[model samples]
Target: MNVSITGLTKEYGKKKALDAITMQLEGNKIYGLLGRNGAGKTTLMQILAGQVMPDGGEVLIGGQKPFENQAITESICLINESENFKKGMKIGDIFKFAGYFYPNWSLETAEKLLEEFSLDKKMKVKSLSKGMESALGITVGLASRSPITIFDEPYIGLDAAARSRFYDLLLEEYEVQERTFILSTHLIDEVSRLLEEVLIVSDGKLLMQKNADELREESFIVNGPRSDVSAFTAGKNVIHRKAFGSMEQAVLYGESKSDARKAGLNVEHVPVQELMVYLTEKTKGGVSA
Candidate 1:
């Protein structure tokens, strides 16, 4: 489903968790909601899922407000990093509840995932390990078949293999069902390939929203002699720069890679993870990409 946010603001005591953030999320695409700790990624996802209300502005999902709206929220599933399920509940009961709560819940898919993750429905929530719990969360989030499914760092304790499996399943589901998936995770490099679009937030404010491919093509790293790099980067939007003796390297946004190469500097595409770090660095004052 399409999600629209307009001047969305949220505050807690003296802190503004979200500050006049405005963006639009198109339907049936994978989005990376990236930011550092306490950057308002969680708060923004909560508001979109109808779990939290904004102090100012609004969030519209599929042309309707999600806050306290059952019809709207029923199509949105948000799996948080932790505290997703009650410890007292059994796995079977949790699945049953999800079946009732989400109109598009698929028990068949859930059962298959349980088998793949080696989770037994008879087990109690408190008895599972952290990785198992995360697996369960992934199963529910995927099986819900919600039009807008948001996963906020949902693989907390999973090993590398398990995380890879989750990524495969997420992509498979997306290809088959074509739903909107907003993933808020710190593992940017791992998930970067799956992201069709990227939304970056910094200090509770919207920094930039751009197509992933375009961002990759526009932002790059250049390295060469200090004088050569400096001359090439002159008047350019350099988000980051460093010097190693006579050699220097600079990360630039919205610059032509071909032009940099012509200037005798080594040009390389910046990984999304590294690009995010440069864009949100405090020294840069959250420069927009």
Candidate 2:
């Protein structure tokens, strides 16, 4: 399920949430939809899921528009941070309703997940705890078996234990049957490992999109004596660097491991989160990227 979104924009009365964004998303991969608060992550996901219309531009899934079309809609599931569940409805009733709309819905998987989450079918929607409600939402996102499954902070109210379980299940399902998964969360450190590619958005605009591994590899961190580190970092495109007294650690790109070694200094693989912070931080002190 290849998705092509080009020149996408969303407009309110006086605001443009997403501005002329363009990207090509391949199928059967995990994408980390990263951004600061109010960076248009939800808007992009909503548009792609066909729940909202863009004021301009297009969203195509398998060469067809996604809005209001039953054929394409069937393959896309958008599990938002907060879902609109009927307060009067029971858990079983919700499942019955969803099963009809989703052709690939599995009764067996739904039942298994229900037990795992310790949810009772007779319980009213209003009676469930916040964590339980989140669990239910995740169950639908996974059990629906949609070609394009999106979780917009699906573990909002879940505890650390439950969230770990959800991640394990998600990876297991992904391994067995390849599906396109897009997860939007502020908990980058926890979920960063699962991302095949990272898309960073800031201030309602796309910042960068690159292979997770390649980005980490091409960039290296150097920590040692200030003079030695400065000399080693000379002529490199320094994204960021930091100094602690006489010692300095610099984060740099545009150089290979061999090149850093040839300069006679210590280099190590920088974690994705650390590299991201260095790249995005306003006060890098002109060093440590």
Candidate 3:
């Protein structure tokens, strides 16, 4: 289940969203897509899912083009943030429609999730609350059991408890049934633990790609005397730095484990969520998350 995207680019009039982006996503891995706003995460997902067309580049899923190919696209599910269910359609009707499109759709799992989320089937989509709408999308996404599952911030408007439920279910589904999962999100801290890989995009370009474990092992937070902390991270790419009184904390992105260890400073692994925040600072002039 390898998805190869080469030279992917998107433009809206004079503004470029994704500039010659290239990536290869292997099977059965959970990927965290991080970026600032306008970094083109949504555009990338939309193109991959065959919902939007890229101005240039090639997208190959399983060694074939995905655009306009139902056989391939049907196997890929994109649960986007803005899942607008029509006003007249009931929740059950939508589920029924999904069952027709996805051969691997699971009604039992869908029913259980519906009950857990307390979503009423008879209610109109327009009448449901924002959180409820998100829950409906999640239920369909999980039940689809598609080979490639891409979630674009599906937990928006969901409460903390609901979000936790989503995380648990996503992991459980992944463990029992190996599938490619790509998560584009702002809730990095909450979902970081589940990510096996991290892909960061900045200013419409691919900035970094690394194994989750390796990244955590290399990055750390250093706090000490101002001069000492600065000296510790003198040559490192400091994601963030702050000082209060004589004490200073500098978040350094080290390339090697030895670099972090030899610093001889207070060190803690970089939290994926926090790292995203620091790496994509507003002052850097791109997205917020």
Candidate 4:
């Protein structure tokens, strides 16, 4: 389902969690929701999942409001870091509940994944380890098959091996059944290749949103003598800069490599993780798409 937010606002006393956010997310695509801590990533996802109400503005899922609307809420599934399942509940019980909740839930897929993750069906929530809990959540998320499925930092206690398994399963399922997946994660480099689009939020506001491929195409760093680098980056969108002795490196947006080479500057492509770090670092202002 397509997600449309118009002037969405949320507040807690004097702090604004979301500030006049406005954007339309296309359907059946993977989006990497990138942001630092307290940058409103959770708030925005909650608003989309109908777990939190906005003080102002509207969120429409498939042209219908999601807040307090079962029609839309039933089609969306959000798996967060803390699931808060009952301590006495068994893993199999949770799967049964998911089957009842999500219309598209698959019991076959759930059972297969439970074995794949080495999670016992009879194990209670409280008895499982942290990584096991995360694996259970991942199992439900993939088997649920909701039209709009969101994962908000869902790999908190997972080890590297298990995390790699999750990524492989996610890609395999997504290939078989295309759906809108919003992955709000801090491991940008780990999941960069899975994202079709990118959304960056900073300081409770939307900073930038663009096609992942296009963003990479336009992002690069220029390094050379301070004077040459400065002159080459003149009037350009400079997100980050560093200098040592007579040398300088400037991370720029939308500057041509040929232009930088013409000005006697060395150019290199900026990795997505590095670009995101420098773009959102200590910046309160928003960047247009």
Candidate 5:
């Protein structure tokens, strides 16, 4: 389903959690919702899921407001970082309830995932370890088959191997099912290849929303002598810069890779995770870059 947010604002006490954030997300594409802690990533996800109402503006799913709208909510599944399942419920009970709540819920997928994750249906939620609990959440989130699935740090306690399996399954599901997936994760580089587009939030504001490939192509690091680096980076958006003795390296946000090469500067692609860090640091004035 298509998601449209217009002037969305949320506040807690005197602080704004989200400030007039406006963006449109098309259906059936994977999106990376990225930001540091306290950057309003969670607030925006909650509001989008209809768990919290915005103080101003609106969120529309499939052209209808999702807040208190069962039709819209049924189509959206948001698996948060914590408090996903009740502590007292059995694993089987949780799956049963999920089947009823999500119209597109697939029992076959759920059962298969249970065996794949080595989760016993009789196991009570409280009895499961953190890794097991995360696996269960992943099972439900994927098997729920909601048109709009939002995973906010879904692999909290999962090991590297399990996480890799989850990534593979996610891509498989996306290709076959063709539904929207909104992923909020700090592990940007790991999932960067899977993201079609990215929405970056900073300090309760929308920083930038761009196609993932285009963003990567436009942003690069140039390295050369301090003077040459300085001249090449002049009149450009420099996200970060570092000096290595007489040599200097600067991260720039523009399509100037060829120009840098022409200027006898060494150019390298910046990983999405590093780019995010540099961008946020620049925004927060953590560095002079």
Candidate 6:
């Protein structure tokens, strides 16, 4: 279930949502799709899940386009932030309908998740609260067991406890099923540990894509006297910097830990959230990473 996107482009009249983006994603891995608001995260996910069409380029799942294709659509399950369940449908009915469409659907998992989330099968879609609705959507995503499962900010109204449960369940299912999971969320720090790879988009362009571990390792923060920081950071890619009189702290890339130590500067690992903040900051009207 590998996914390949080549020169993908999309627009809405005068607004360009995506611009000639190209990337390949391997199956059976967890990916964190990261972007700021209006950065085309939703558009990209829609295009990948076959719910929308790209104006240019192609998206291939297992070497075939997903749009309007029964086989591919059935194999990919995308749970969005806001689910639109039938007004009159019950939780049981929704599960039953999903089981029919998904070849790998698991009734047992669905039932267990309902109990864990404290949702009743007899409950009508209209009666469930926001958190309950999100829980149901997550249940569908996990129980579907689709080869390509995508969750686009699916835990909107979930509380801390319920959200923790969802994370545990996701990892449990992934360990057993080994399916590809693409998680798009604003809670970067909370989910950073779960990501194997990361993709960042900004202003209709792909900014960066890298393995989570290597990205963190290669990204180091330097702090020391302002003069020492300035001398050490010369010729290096400076992602971010802050100065307060004689003290200074800077975020840099492509600079090794040994180099920082040799320059008599303090080096520390940058957290995923901080890294994203500095990497995505607007510079000269363009996002830099």
Question: Of the candidates shown, which would achieve the greatest TM-score relative to the real structure?
Answer: 1
Ranking by lDDT: 1, 6, 5, 4, 3, 2
Q: Sort by TM-score, best first.
A: 1, 5, 6, 4, 3, 2
Please, what are the lDDT tens digits per residue for candidate 2 over residues 115-201?
999998898889988888898888888888888999999988899999989999899888867899999988877887899998876
List the RMSD of every prediction in angstroms.
1.0, 2.6, 2.8, 1.6, 2.1, 1.6
Among residues 3 or more apart in sequence or in different chains, the pairs in candidate 5 whose N, CA or C atoms overlap within 3 Å are none
| Best candidate (score: lDDT) | 1
lDDT of 6: 0.90
- Mark the regions of model 6 whose C-alpha exceeds 4 Å error after superposition: 284-289
TM values, all candidates: 0.98, 0.91, 0.93, 0.95, 0.97, 0.96
Give the runs in model 5 whose Cα sits over 4 Å from its true position.
282-289
Residue-pair clash count for candidate 1? 0
Of 1 and 5, the candidate ahead on lDDT is 1
- Clash pairs (backbone) in predicted model 4: none
lDDT of 6 by residue, 78-102 (tens): 9989865776899999999999999
Q: Which stretches of candidate 4 lie over 4 Å from their true place?
A: 283-289
- Candidate with more favorable, higher TM-score: 2 or 6: 6
Please provide, for model 4 over 1-289, each residue's C-alpha lDDT reduced to its tens digit, 9 standing for 90 to 100: 8999999999999999999999999999999999889999999999898889999998999999888988888888899897647889998889889988899998888999999989888999999888888888888889989999999888889988888888899999898888999999999888998999999998788888889999988888899999998888888888888999999998888767788888878889888888888878775212435
lDDT (C-alpha) at residue 269 in model 3: 71
The residue-by-residue lDDT of candidate 3 on 209-278, one tens digit each, is 8899888986778777888888777666777888999999877775554665676667777688778777
- Per-residue lDDT value at 54 in model 3: 83
Candidate 2: minimum summed lDDT over ten consecutive residues — where?
Answer: 280-289
lDDT of each: 0.93, 0.83, 0.84, 0.88, 0.89, 0.90
